[model samples]
Target: MAVTKRVVLHFPRRLVEQPVIYRLVKDYNLEFNILRASITAEPEEEGLLVLQLKGEQEEYDRGVKFLLKSGLKIQSLSQDVTRNEARCTSCGACVTLCPPGAFVVDPKTRQVNFDDEKCVACGLCIKACPPRAMEVHF
Candidate 1:
């Protein structure tokens, strides 16, 4: 069986410069789609990356375990973005900030389409939505 999961990874300073994604792809044979990233070798902060991994169930499980054993903080994501229909104006403000184009405007109806599958919980939509229609959890 095939499955995909979104998770947040926090890299310690020691592993900040490592090719973590490359390892996940080459060793685990997992497909990694980076949704959001701010990883850097900075003095004040740890590296952070939000991504979705796709592969066989067993491989996915082992890959997550490998990440944990490698000292990377891995938190599986539940739901990323949600929208309140009544509060939305379909103004398309969030379309620009969304990296994955999750918030798309339907040209036929001039309505906004909120595809949860495409969202990675980047949290940029929360501030970009003028009416605060979009909410982000974690």
Candidate 2:
């Protein structure tokens, strides 16, 4: 079966220049979508990458093992971005800011709806929410 997972990868200075993603694809036969990345050219700086990876379950496991052996610190992006219904005023502030379109406005009721499955935990909603209804649990 195929599986998809979001993960954060921290690359030490030594591995910053390596083609880790390329290896994941070529060697492990895994596909990835890079959500965000910050890697400086300076040799002294470390790199950070957020990715959504997909592959067969066994291939995914092998890819993870490869990452660990390559000296990358990996963390599952299981962080939750939640909305407090009580505090939510149905304002559509989050609708435009959410990268994944996790928030939508109900046309009939003019109420805002949130889909947790669509959230990517980018935290943009938390900062944009006027009522402080959005919360991030890391």
Candidate 3:
């Protein structure tokens, strides 16, 4: 079965320069879409990467195992951020705060639309929402 999974990867300072992502494609036959990345060239600082990986279920599992063996800390990107429609007032408070533009206003309807797929669970919208419509769930 084919599967796609979003994940967060933590790279230790020592492994930051390695071609870890390349191995996923060449050895594991996985496809990846990078959502966000914060990598520092400094030798003392660690690197962080958020990405969606897609492949067969068996291949995905193998790729994840490779990441673990390479000393990378892995976390599921399952932090679900949702907006309560009843509590939302289309105030557009979260429109500007979202980093990925997950919230957008319909030009004609003047209503806010939430695209959950684009959200990175940054929690900025949750804090900016006046009606407390935005929420994050682990």
What are the clash counts of all predictions, listed in order?
Answer: 0, 0, 0
TM-score of predicted structure 1? 0.69
Give lDDT per model, in order: 0.84, 0.86, 0.87
Off by over 4 Å in 3: 42-44, 80-92, 95-118, 121-138
**Candidate rank order under lDDT:** 3, 2, 1
TM-score of decoy 3: 0.66
The window of 10 residues in a row where model 3 has the poorest summed lDDT is 75-84
Model 1 clash tally? 0
Q: Give each model a TM-score.
A: 0.69, 0.74, 0.66
Question: lDDT (0-100) at residue 66 of candidate 2?
Answer: 96
Judged by lDDT relative to the true structure, which candidate is superior, 1 or 2? 2
Put down candidate 3 lDDT per residue, 1-138, tens digits, no spaces.
999888888899888889999999999999999877888888787798888999999999999999999999898875566788999999898898889798989999999999877787777888789999988654
- For model 2, how does the per-residue alpha-carbon lDDT over 4-62 read when each residue is reduced to its tens digit? 89887889888877999999999999999987788888777779888899999999999
Q: Which prediction has the highest TM-score against the true structure?
A: 2
Q: Which pairs clash (backbone N, Cα, C closer than 3 Å) in model 3?
A: none
Q: What is the lDDT of candidate 2?
A: 0.86
